[model samples]
Target: MDTLTSTSANTWPIISNIIGWTYFLSWSCSFYPQTILNFKRKSVQGLSIDFLYYNVFGFLCYSIFNLAFFFSEDVQDEYRRRHQDSDNLVRANDVLFAVHAFLISFLTLSQTFIFKSDQKLSVTAKTFLLTFIVFILTAIGAVFTEYIKWIDVLYFLSYIKLLISFIKYIPQLWMNYRRKSTIGWSIHNILLDLSGGILSVAQLVLDAAISGDWSGITGDPVKFGLGFVAIVFDLLFMSQHYIFYRERYDFYLAVDDSERQALLPTEQS
Candidate 1:
């Protein structure tokens, strides 16, 4: 059965590769909407500062994890030894996506300094920032002391990324609620994020199904959980933009005198 499943999984590489790259494109493209929006408006006024910081940091850790796992044979061998797996689950597209995401997230963070914006990271975000720094340092110390392998550090970093991704949306959601607007925060970003997230989860499930190894999904749920959390948050963001705060967003960005007048009177009240 294992041999049969392995052969089946080998045959599925082409299809899985296609789906993997599709999600990569979806996720990589998702970053551009907000980047372009910031440039177009010449401001990051309505964008959440905390979101940018958390996103960049999360992707930084994720990039390290993915790149190490993909390129470091040591990590791969350790992974297989740890999991007793024959196939290497790390894909080139995964590494590319993570690196690209980190670069893009960093680019957005740069805009916060370059663009017109008075917003600063909130107290909660600051705490998280410090925690991430300490976590990385501690992991490095463990690696130096030979208490943990580099592969173990990479695994820890990946898990940290998952946690960061899961919580990163909260500040943005709260910011939008407080401001009652999603102006500088592009709705297109949310839509693309939702698509990417859904596709990511689909890819994982497809890979697991083909390999007949439910272990990755059942045993290692970080990636799956992050994807699921992103989808949920994206829906909430959609609601904020299209339902809950729609009128406020429209009114806030309504520059034309006629357009401003066309907004619901309740917005003015």
Candidate 2:
């Protein structure tokens, strides 16, 4: 059972912190444009409710996972015991990013309630949410019944978040396709998210370089996969905004220019 040579905390502490916080800010900032857009339109029209539901729930799980792994000695010990004493990869920025992302996602959900919009959680979203509820409850039962450790509960929570990451973006992409426009949705959000995803993957590479082992990535391929998925979706969104739906977007602003005026913020390609 080959694994990372040494994982008792990161060796490159300062450099790791810098990379961690940079991506933290980038990923945390990714929610702003959508928030601002919702305010500008006084609507969450093009924003998908399914996306928000998934986003909010996913981040909540992620937040718990990060917080527990980073802050809980019991969880940390259990994790190490399970993983042959491998240090948990969670960093301060990981906890901060997860908490901040959850807050932002929750704020966006609140906006959906305040604004004028007809979108409701899809049956699919509801089903997934309910399914996660069952998953979470079962994890709790396992923990209390001594079937699994608290750290295992944390991992299960993260797994739900991971599953949601793969599913969350689809609604937004489909909405853009159906409307043939990316107007109400902000492209800036995608750009910032793309930067975060790229940086996240880069950070993994940097860690591997310093450690002289790629096992950090290979060991938990889900982390790498999540970054890759985000990057792929961000690129697809870039295409939808800049190429596929440019005409529709331009026409939207052209028609609404009189009303939207300066309220509709513009972004660069």
Candidate 3:
């Protein structure tokens, strides 16, 4: 079998690995700030629930899909193992799936509660009803396992949700770009996003070089185009915040000290 390779073949993997690691670390490091903000604010006041809701749903879908894919891979691995086929590939896939799935699942699930806490009663009521319906549908599909391919439905929903998320972010990106500021943006997230963007483009380029087409990197140019633009502007936004609007980034620290100070009433007294 011949694989058309890129000069970036070895480099791309290292880059991709680095990108993934940075993403994971960024999110992990950011958790404390976001958690403290929500805790002290007692609200998700300035956050966009639309972003959180779609992401949470998407992560839930991805987690479920990961389990399904892992099971399938395990079955294939078991058969191959008996036949003395290479176990290395299977092991690699298992580790990859476990890491990606667990990180996404944990982040989404944890953030969901934080956002939920901040939602208004009316908003919360609506979200709960919608989530309940999705759960019920998913449960019914689980019950009729063979006939109902609930995972597929969830995957489709996730796809749609990501589409909607991009759409939502588009206007925000444009508005921010035009204004040349990221007034209310999260610097940590923007920084992570900027890095993710470059890595994503590299991944796409590498994939295209390998396959001689843009098949696996992303679905199509339209989707890829949207992602590209979003990422580019996100980098710009992050740069603006880092260079010009450093004060807002302190929103994270302020939340932390406020919480700390609250806990020690005698210190003020």
Candidate 4:
């Protein structure tokens, strides 16, 4: 029994690391699908600009959180002591993922400006102004936190990121519902996001189980909750794409065919 328990304990971190890397890879690639879809379609129609707006800000907060955690001596020391590793608990890929997310979201936002779309889902001028103001305020806050050496602001930024993550999908989900179709959104992106979210939660679970440290599970409730919520949203998106949109598309096709038949005799005469 002792040998079995020892082996499981030894194997868990390796499994956790594997899951972490899988999540990193999934997250890294997730944004590309939307970018590519937008480029190929040459339009941001049916895509919510508000989603991109919130996403860029969310990624910005997440990036700050990762950078602050990675650089904090206190955080590094604690992680090293607990894990008996020289490296901090926060992985370099976390920072990289955050950076990539911001960049990709920015790219998607650029598409909203550059591409012409008749879709009403696009952000309004008033919303753009509001977003600009928010950005400026956030920048000022960041500067203030840095100059004052208010390190606890890092936690605030992390919580903001979590809040943004929780709400960011809402606009997109609502837009899809209003449109009754997921026409312009990329299912590939949602699938990748789901994979990443599941892997992230799995890593946390494995780590907690292996270390027999339940506190580790609750230590970062934001991270855990974000993963779970993201997965739920991703699944909702998949259902919208596969089930709801499919039905809507078929209905539209039938209506179009009927209209065409009705016009046939008029055109013939």
Candidate 5:
């Protein structure tokens, strides 16, 4: 069993590598367009805030978890005689770190431009901003992690931010579930999120099992568990969309038109 455990840890790199890139490609190619469309429309009119907020939070937590895993390893290696610079785990971490950095960049960029008006930024311009923010932040975080004693606090902030962000979504979830419609939901986004959540939990469990650390496997299981539960809810949310996908109704970009129609029924009717 011990050998098996060690072998599993050794194999984690390959598994994680495959899973991580799969998510990256899927999100980049499939889900990103929906967000871009929503931006063009300037209405999250049919998009679910609960889902988006939860995802942002989840990414933050995952980022922190990744950082902690690295920190713990650095501590462990410090006690050894001569540390090998090219360990498999180190290489895996590097890959994961880059992946997460990209995730954060894309997300933040999406948030910034996806909610903005068309006049504000061209598609190419938004892409540039996303790339810039992602690069700058990833570089800064990497540097800080290596040189600063207080950097662990940044990881702590990431965890806390996730929790707060997740909590902010509860009301939105309840309201949407009660209404039985995704009046403000984006199906593709939620679908991708559900996939991401499953991958995240799987990665966490694999890491925990390999390391023999139940705590690390489950980061603040209460918070983590809630996030997982939220992901499941997201799946259900997407189901709601699937059941109603063929229904045709206008999702407006603004409320002004609706209000005007109400006030002057004779003008158009």
Candidate 6:
């Protein structure tokens, strides 16, 4: 019985590590599909500039969160003390993924400037930027005055990352609805993103099971919520792609057929 139990315990961490790496890969590559699609199309017509705006800033926050968490000895010690399972703790991959995400987002933003597209910054984008600026200034002031501890600042950054993750899709969702098409967007990216989200959540679950610690399941609530919400939004985008946007393309094909037929008759006459 001891041998069996030991074997089971040993296997779970290996499985968890596999899932974690898979999640990392999925997320790391998720942006490429959209970036490639944009380059191929040479237009951001159906894409939302506001979406890019929020994404860039969101990733910036995420990068900061990862950096602060990785560097702060206090945070690291607390995490170790709380979890008591060092194997399942945050690794270099987490920081690497954050860095990769930020770079990809910046590249996507560059696309907006390089490519000619009808998409423009919406009122919502402006509002978000302004609000984010104010929040950053306030946080800086608080930090300078020592009104909030560095650990608390780390928590605040984590919250910002969570907020950004939760709402980042709104601009694109709204834009797709307004345009009634997903022409300029890449469904492939959403598919990859959904895959990453599921894998990330699975990693968390596996860690919980392996360590036999569930108290902290929600301890990093924002990280957990980010994965879950990303999955939700990815599905939403997929539905939009198949149900709504597909019909639009079909209608466009029909119109083209009719116009071609009309021209043929005129040419025959």
Candidate number achieving the greatest TM-score relative to the actual structure: 1
Q: How far in Å is the alpha carbon of 109 misplaced in model 4? A: 1.4
Compose the digit string of candidate 1's lDDT tens values, residues 180-223.
76767888888888888887888777777776666656434656
lDDT of 4 by residue, 1-269 (tens): 21227846667677778888889899889999989888876778668876787788778877877777777787666555655443434566677888888888998888987896554434553464366457546755876767523334555566667777877788789878876778678889999999999988887776666656556655555567768988999999999988876633322123566875764453233
Clash count (model 5, backbone only):
5
TM values, all candidates:
0.87, 0.86, 0.51, 0.75, 0.53, 0.84
Q: What C-alpha lDDT does candidate 5 achieve relative to the native structure? A: 0.49
Q: Which pairs clash in model 3?
A: none
Model 6 / residue 179 / CA error / Å = 1.8
The global C-alpha lDDT for each of the candidates, from Candidate 1 onward, is 0.80, 0.79, 0.47, 0.72, 0.49, 0.75
> Superposing every Cα of model 3 onto the true structure, what RMSD results?
8.9
Q: Write the per-residue lDDT of candidate 6 for residues 153-256, one digit (tens) a residue.
A: 66677787788787778888987787667767888899889998998888877676666666455556666777899999999999999986674332222356
Task: Tell me the lDDT of candidate 4.
Answer: 0.72
Winner of 2 and 3 under TM-score = 2
- The lowest-lDDT stretch of 10 consecutive residues in candidate 4 is 246-255
Between candidates 3 and 4, name the one with more favorable lDDT: 4
For residue 12, model 2's alpha carbon misses the true position, in angstroms, by: 4.5
Question: Which regions of candidate 6 fall more than 4 Å away from where they truly are?
Answer: 1-5, 78-88, 247-269
Better of 2 and 4 by TM-score: 2
- Once model 3 is optimally superposed onto the true structure by TM-score, how far is the C-alpha of residue 152 displaced, in angstroms? 3.5
Candidate 3 Cα outliers beyond 4 Å, as residue runs: 1-3, 6-33, 36-44, 74-151, 167-185, 211-213, 218-269
The candidate, 1 or 2, that scores higher on TM-score is 1
